[model samples]
Target chain A: MPIDRDDARRVAHLARIRVDEEDLPALASEFNAILGFIEQLREVDVRDVEPMTSVTPMRLKRREDRIAGGGIAEKVLANAPDAREGYFVVPKVVE
Target chain B: MDGLNSLSISEARDRLRVGEITSMELTQACLAAVEEAAALNAVVHPTPDLAHEQAKAADARLAAGQAPAMCGIPVGIKDLFCTEGVPSQAASGILAGFKPAYESTVTSRLFEAGAVMTGKLNMDEFAMGSSTETSVYGNTVNPWKSGDTELTPGGSSGGSAAAVAADLCLGATGTDTGGSIRQPAAFTGITGVKPTYGRVSRWGIIAFASSLDQAGPMTKSVRDAAIMLEAMSGHDPKDSTSADIPVPNFEGILTGEVRGKTVGIPKEYRMEGMPEAIDELWASGRSMLEDAGATLVDISLPHTKVALPAYYVVAPAEASSNLARYDGVRYGHRATLAQGDDITAMYERTRAEGFGDEVKRRVMIGTYVLSAGFYDAYYNHARKVRALIKKDFEDVFAEGVDAILTPATPSAAFPLGQKFDDPVQMYLNDVFTVTVNLAGLPGISVPAGLDPDGLPLGLQLIGKPWEEGELLDFALAIEDRAGFVAKPKRWW
Candidate 1:
């Protein structure tokens, strides 16, 4: 199915990317092209085929649910765009 | 003696051990070559002082009678691999000015093996594009050219391939999520191998698609690839997916003997509209292996045609989720927020301003597929198709096919800006390569021959999972018989 401009805007919003109103047409067209190509997968008979997530047959290695590492707040926050008082400073979430 | 920059890792290792050359001399030669080839736009960040210091340390180790295989060798670390305090962007503006306090596991392992880091090399932004055009540092030109018609070094590991082909470094680290390593190696006429999915640790390398991403080596020759891969691979407790199996001595196991090996040529790969030169190169590659005492057989992978579609769906889906961590809050680039803007607005603006066109396109596709209404049709179906694709390879291997051979790329390096307009056309560059990634198998692209246009053409060899040693042995046979020693002349 060809994605429309509204669909492109919704996807951009869902992905947390702000798409300008003017660019939605171009974005919609690009999405349509890619999805049109991807539509070919529907033709394959995937009856009873288990979806493969990990290529190898190994379970996720689990460990004790205990905190083993941390406490270097400065190093952790080194790359943050805005960090103050050992925490990331983001725009106010509360009204 | 020829310049140290031009020597292979194995050759340089031998030279360093025999005291014929010091690591400092080799490092200087490479540094000079990097300076001379500045027009290539290959090395994004040159770490000359770190390289010199590492070289001195390597020399001291050699003096004390301790020499690892990679001792004193200067290699380029792709920009994706984080080096402590070095700006490790995946060639994306979103990662602008983000320097990691910790080094990636692969680079640290290479350093442990006494390798010197020459610099951070360029790559496709977030390892996304097939050509280096997506790189924020600018496109890395292919060292091989067709008479002044500048070409792309295929990415997302384009800089690693270009540097190795141009001899700026002995070998460079490369990551192959889809065709990043193999395609660029083919375009630049070098050797690159993407080892089994968990063979190399993905601990510190920025995640694109966690399931498909793998790190490997881009080098001048097959032997160099083997040596470097041995150093770059090992199980890390830090990476849960890293295999618990012991690392093999890949270089030592190179018997160059594919005798009695049954090499399969998948009938499906003979796609319609394939270039005549690619067909010729594939036939000649088969004969070379046959002459080296391996038997060739015809096989079928019926799902081959659908692998690309499945990959586009799965890769983008995964990328969307992985990239969600890059909001304005934690790290990397953030957009200026006007007063009264909320957190959600900040996130949207930061991501919108930070990501490039291609990345945004992928993120959009990803979110569309995974959205509430369409997840089952696109994302779930693509995962099942991926299973079928993997089973196709497994059935062939179970039938005693030692490896599968095919053209590394549909064609050699095309002129830059040729395929940028159409995304599907650019995606087709990974047609011959995406299956290996989908199946999580080891695949190597060996420089097999030159096309009639005097550009390099490569032959890909896909091996059983975690069997890179055997794959490299087959590649060595092809490399030896093909006798492809042509190098691009110094035009840059």
Candidate 2:
């Protein structure tokens, strides 16, 4: 399966990464190359095989629904690029 | 160059226990060596103040007659492991100047064991590339040289391998998703162990491909790897994938006795056009194990050829999801917006400026594969193939095969820029090692011999799940037989 320039541009959008129009051709070609490599998996007979949910045989561990630990809002927001009044600031979305 | 910093972990431990040397002295020696070897670009963030503080604490522990094997030993922490108040950038511009508020579980354990932290070593950005060339800090040059050309230390654990090989640090931490640890170890003539999945806690290590990512040790020798790995392994409640199993005394079980053990030679790994030197090295490893009273049996892993392709799919898909937290709203780099750009534009521009070319390529591919109408065709299909790849190992192990032996890498270290432009060629470097990760089994790379160019090559040993003790024991056997004491001439 080959991806065209339009598909590449759409993928960059879906990934929330900006890809210029001029670079879409090169990106599409790179996608084609990788897709060509992975296309070999189509040949494997996976009729009755189950997709692996976990590598180990163990089930997901259950835990009590209690607060583990959280109170230092300053510590949690320490790395935030823009924090005001102990809240992360992002661009206005509902305008 | 024969200094305290060059001493192996076991050697340093013995010296520290007998009061022959202080942790402060060892830490100073390593700090000076890290300064001298600045050309290698191995230690990206040298934490001298923290190192001195840790050394003082370790010396106190040693004097109190309470010391573990790692007490007073100076080791490099790969930048992927977040250290509180220390820069833990995974060699990425996106994470430029990012410091975690808390300590990673692995580093915390090492510190609790009284291990001295020399510094944070370099790695591929987000552990993405095979060459460390993708590092925002720049390429970490391999201490080994081929002619006048500077070779890669082999990534994304390239800095870890280079630091250990160059004796800048006694041992260093490394994480292997797809041969990040083993490949670099082979390239630098050291020992690297990728313990069975769930063996080491991944609580604070920056995520790449969660299912496949595993933290291990890269050291000068197999015994040193054993000592370092035991200190690093255990269960953590923070990481649910962490196994709740007892970490065996890895160093104690390394008796170098493999009598009557059966080693499997996977027929599928003998890829066509493999460098003759690598093939010869594999043969020597086989004979060495046989000489140690182990029986050699030829086996077939029919899905070996698909491991690499499947890995590229699975790893990137997970990476695409794991890396989604790097939005402009929170930590790390946020692109300065243009006059009228909206929130979506903010995300697009920030990510565009943040990620490198290879990272962008992977993210795009991952998004394309996981998109509507293509999910079953690519992502789920790859998962089924991954199951088959895992079963291939299960079938072999069930038939009394104690371990499998193969070339650690397709070849020895190449010049830094040789395959930088060709992503496919670079991906081929992990051909022989990805099968172990896909199967979630323990695997190790022990420096076996040198190529015709006098570059070091490693032989890999694959073991049953959660059997790292046995794996390390077999690796010790190979290490003793090979006697791989050759070191690169120090030019750095």
Candidate 3:
């Protein structure tokens, strides 16, 4: 399917990226070109073929469901843009 | 350039063993070379202090009669692999100034084996682009320049290729999602191997497409690749997907004997409108293998044409999911928000200001494909197609085909601005190498010959899953016969 400007805007929003209104056409065109290339997959016969979830055949490795690590809250908060009292500070979410 | 800096890992290791050279001297030579070649922009974050400390420790280890194969060798760590307190930006503005508290498993293993880190190397932002032009540090110049025209060292492992080819470092770490290591290695006249899926631990490497991403070595020769890959491979418990298989002594098994080995040349790789030089290179590569006593056969892999399309869908889909962690709150770059901006606006603005054009385009594509209305059509269908591509390789391997040989890239290194504007045309550079990534097979790019312009061209050898040692043996056979010793004259 061809992605229109509106679709590009919506995709940018979905990806949490802000796309300027004027650049939407260029973004949409790029998306269309990529999609047009991949659209050739429509001809690939995939009947009875399972979607490859993992490249290697291995089960999800499970460990004990407990707190195995952590306690270094300082290190965790080291690279945060804004932090106070061992918590990341973000813009106000709740009024 | 006539110093220890030009020595390969095997040569340097032998010298270190006999006490003919110290790791400190070798590292200093490389550091001096790196300083002189700043025009290449290959080393993004030069850790001279760390390199000296590591070299001192390595020299002590060498003197104490404790030596690993990689002991006292200076290698470049790709920016994608997080080294403790060092910039591990993945060459993306989104990760600007970000440094992890821990080292990546591969780097840690290399360090444990006494491999000294020269610095963090440049790469495409998020390992997304074919050329290193998408890098935050700008594109790494290919050492092999065709006349005065500057060429790209194909990426996202471009810096690793450049550093190895230019003798700035003996060997460098590289990551391959879709031909990142192999393509750059091919363009720069070096050796690169993308090991079988789960063969090398991916822990602490910045995720691009988790299922498709792999770490490998970019070096001067296949022997160096084997030695470095042995140090880089292991089962890391931290990485759940890391295989529990035993690590083999890859360098010890180099017989260079391909006698009676059945090598297949897939007919699908002979694409329409292929450059004549690449075709001639492929033919000459077959002769080299034949002369080395390997039997060649023509094979069919019908799904080859669709592999590129399937890769675009799956890789972008995974990239979108993997990159979601780069919010404005936790780490890396955060946009300067105006007053009254909400949390959602913070996320949108930070991502917009941080990511490059190519990264945003990929993220947009990924979001569209995985969106609710199109998930089944684009994402799931591509996964199913990926299954078919993997099966194509499996069938060929089952038919007694030990390995497959093909051109590493369609053409030699192009000028910097040649294919950057067209994404589709740029993606085609990986046509011959992507299938190996899709099928989770080990693939190596060995420098085979030079194009008419005197630029290097490499031939790729694809091997069975977890059979990297065997693959290296075959590559050694080609390396012995091809004798590709031409190096780009120093211009930097």
Ten residues in a row with the worst lDDT in model 1 chain B? B360-369
Order the candidate numbers by DockQ, best to worst: 3, 1, 2
Give all candidates' CA lDDT scores: 0.94, 0.92, 0.93
> Which of candidates 1 and 3 is the stronger one according to DockQ?
3
- Writing each residue's lDDT as its tens digit, candidate 2 over B335-396 gives 99888788999899989998999888888788878889998988998999999999999999
Q: Could you give candidate 1's per-residue lDDT for residues B207-317 as a string of tens digits?
A: 998999999999999999999999999999899999989889999999889999999999999989998999999999999998999999999999999999999999999
lDDT of 2 by residue, A23-63 (tens): 99998898898889988888888899999889988866788
TM-scores of all models?
Answer: 0.99, 0.99, 0.99
Clashing residue pairs for model 1:
none
For the predicted complex of model 2, DockQ is 0.85
In candidate 2 chain B, where is summed lDDT lowest over 10 consecutive residues?
B89-98
Over the stretch B1-492, how does candidate 3's per-residue lDDT look in tens digits? Answer: 299999999999999988999999999999999999999999999999999999999999999986998999999999999999999999999888888988899999999999999999999999998889999898999999999999999999999999999999999999999999999999999999999999999999999998999999999999999999999998988999999989899999878888999999999999899989999999998998899899999999999999999999999999999999999788999999899999999999999999998898888888888999899999999999999999998998999999999999999998998989999999998899998889899999999999999999999999999999889988998899888999998999
Give the Å shift of residue A25 in candidate 1: 0.9
Which candidate number would show the highest DockQ if scored against the true structure? 3
Model 1 interface DockQ: 0.89
Model 1: docking quality category:
high
The positional error of residue B9 in candidate 3, measured at the CA in angstroms, is 0.4
